[model samples]
Target: MGFNRPSRIQENALPMMLAEPPQNLIAQSQSGTGKTAAFALAMLSRVDTAQKVTQCLCISPTFELAVQTGKVIEQMGKYYPEVKLAYAIRGNRVERGTKIQDHIVIGTPGTVLDWCSKLRFIDPKKIKILVLDEADVMIATQGHQDQSIRIQRMLPTDCQMLLFSATFEESVWKFSERVIPDPNIIKLKREEETLDTIKQYYMVCKRNQDKFTAICNVYGAITIAQAMIFCHTRKTAAWLASQLCREGHQVALLSGEMTVEQRADVIQRFRDGKEKVLVTTNVCARGIDVEQVSIVINFDLPVDKDGKTDNETYLHRIGRTGRFGKKGLAVNMVDSQYSMEVLREIEEHFNKKILKLNPNDPDDLIKLEDIHN
Candidate 1:
């Protein structure tokens, strides 16, 4: 609410979103453009204070995002003290068998669906507004798609729907057509997709094993506030974290394999600046915003199980840094012909050139530090 001026997405969509008769919305904008604030405002405006049942439901792709969105809603609704909010995420302290009396409920799709269908914790019939934050991720991922569809089917007819994400792939767009009928669409052009605040570069390695040395060289050559190194698999992430720690670097690991509590603890420690480096897989790719992350490294470029380059994943991975117009850096480690091909595809897709860096030259690596200065 302290915003002095409206962001582009907020300026364009907020008016139509808060019109007299609510309308379905599908918006695609880059991260850190105030998309969360836009949706949070729309969700809060629809809450019925007198109703004891849940009236507004916001679902995200991950537990971290769910908790973060809930906090945003709370912070924005500071003036409305009576606007009750409930979080239905893993490890949430909400007691079992408790009927959720909150006016707004924020959670992950699977957990929210369970509370609605199995636990009967919240009455779905009374829901007035449904928001799917990071809609593209929830719709494109394998298991998450089915869960999101099932959750949507359970909601009452005529309920207002809002879907927001940084990307809306063709498949995701087709799926959204069926879910949100005659929706008002807002999207950014391809040229406008990449963040101007990020300084992107790539380091070519002679061999696969040389990547670790290249990463360490970058760290030694620059002063990184905090960095997130993205790996293609959990095994790789664990291995990298261990190797970094053994080399006397402060590092932590996060993956889907860890228990929810473990993931939460690692994220909290990193966010609090207790841990300076976090090596993770795609688990922290989307909707996990950490403002202090000035550098993002692709230890392994993101690819699907089929080994094809995942452009959306790449966008989200780099989006982790350069948050909210802050200066940041993204470094890609390309050690093989295949990785180079993938990097080329990403470059063509984003229509931006990623400069090559010679890790052996401290001058090239010092460019990362220059932006921070």
Candidate 2:
């Protein structure tokens, strides 16, 4: 809502998306580029608030993403008092055979599928707009892909479909073709995948304890409004959160093991600036936009199951900061040989250098802190 200018993707994609004859769109852009706002405006513009019969639907891969998207729409449509929104995610209950009368509905694929197929809460025939956030994840996951396709099949032929994400693979394209027909496409070059506003750096630590010490040094020296630390595993996240907590830092932890409501609550607290540091696994990697997050710490470099460098995850992790034209910082801690290789590959893939930082030096930490400001 503080957007002073339209981002590149928004400038090019909005006209087509908000046309009189609704159009389908498939857009690819880096995080912090106003992709969600673009789609949210389109969804709001298309909804017939006068009728209030679930005229528009937005689907995301996770509860957090769906909730985030719902918040955007809510903020954008705040003046439109007649517009009502409903979340189809878990814990949002509706009785059997209950009809949904909200103007906009948002939720995860499985829950949205249940509301459409089993619950019959919203009539697909009445929906005029459909949006899928984080489409690459939506299609690559088997269960999500199946449920998304099933939900698409139930929609009317004229329903305007929109898909937004940071990456689009060959498989995702194939899946997009199936869900959307003749969509206007918007894509960025490979080199543009990483954000330029976020100053990047790396500090090599000989041991895990050294990494923790480095983190303490940085936090002790800098006045970070909010920082997100990403770990390779849930165990690492829990340990780091506990360690930070013991050090008297207001810390919050999030991972796959936590329930949907618990995860949402943790994120809410972080957004409200109740936590100074948030330690997490990959759950908050994509589409979690917290504007106050000025620093993103890669406590452990991201790698896939086969130990391959996940460039997309790295981009998303850093993208959490540097949001909406704000200067931010991303610091990577290389504690092992494998992590060193992972960082090197990520550097080469993005063609960006990660400057060396001396964690023990006060001057070096102060410089790192200034990069974000």
Candidate 3:
């Protein structure tokens, strides 16, 4: 709780959330802008610690984010030692017929659903507060929307509802009406969704190896507090990590195949500064808030399953670096005609220009750093 004062989103959303006769809220704020804390405080304030029941519940799209939210709730509720919390994620198994006595629960949607209905570990009717962190991503992902709707239906009529995320598309907005109808809403304009603090650029590479060399130049030229490299596929991420390792750089690789514990450990180690470079896919893209990440490299430009340009994913990728109004950088590697088309689409979608940079020049990188400073 090193918060000197309430952030913009917190100042506006927290009052409506923590007011008398609790109200439902739908807030949209950029990453690393205290959205989790706003909802965490609201959940903790609504719980009765002496009852030892699961009064508050929070769900995230991925296991890493669930654990991340759990840690924040843990730190903020330090004074109330009696306020116990439990995780309903994979690998944290509970025997059949066991009941959870914790006052707060944080988990992924499927596990949380099973615990509340099938396993009977938590009483859905007894839950007084429900928070869906990263709701846009949660609704967009397959199967998460249905499971979340089920959980929402199980809660009592008076239960307070909260949904938070950085960006929301037209489709997801329509879907929110079914979950929390007629809730107070707050969000930014489409043009302001991508922060001005993050300087954007695109470097044309003749081949994949040139892209790797360009990354090396960026690392050797700039004074990066930390850097995250995002690849669209696991093959590219593995190859880049190995190449960086061969260059005598400490790097970490994260992909979809890694177990929950392994992924959590890798993220924690990167957060602790054990590694300066982390090469990963879109798994860590949504809401992982690491303050030291000064730059992000799109080793591959983001695209949806149908190979169309995904502007929302691109925003989340760059949003990882610039935290709480700090300056950050994003560089995209364009190697093919398809990539070029995707890049152009992204620029037009965001209504901002992505400046061009020479991929082979070391001096060009220094200029970017100078501008960054």
Q: Kindly report which residue pairs in candidate 2 clash with one another.
A: none
- lDDT string, candidate 2, 127-154, tens digits: 8999988888777566999999899999
| Sort by lDDT, top down from the best | 3, 2, 1
Indicate which candidate wins on TM-score: 3
Off by over 4 Å in 2: 189-193
lDDT against the true structure, per candidate, is 0.85, 0.87, 0.89
Per-residue lDDT value at 212 in model 1: 86
Cα misplacement distance, residue 33 of candidate 3 (Å): 1.2
What is the Cα-based TM-score of model 3? 0.97
In order of appearance, the predictions have TM-scores of 0.92, 0.95, 0.97
What's the lDDT for residue 312 in model 3?
85
Model 1: residue 76 alpha-carbon error in angstroms:
1.7
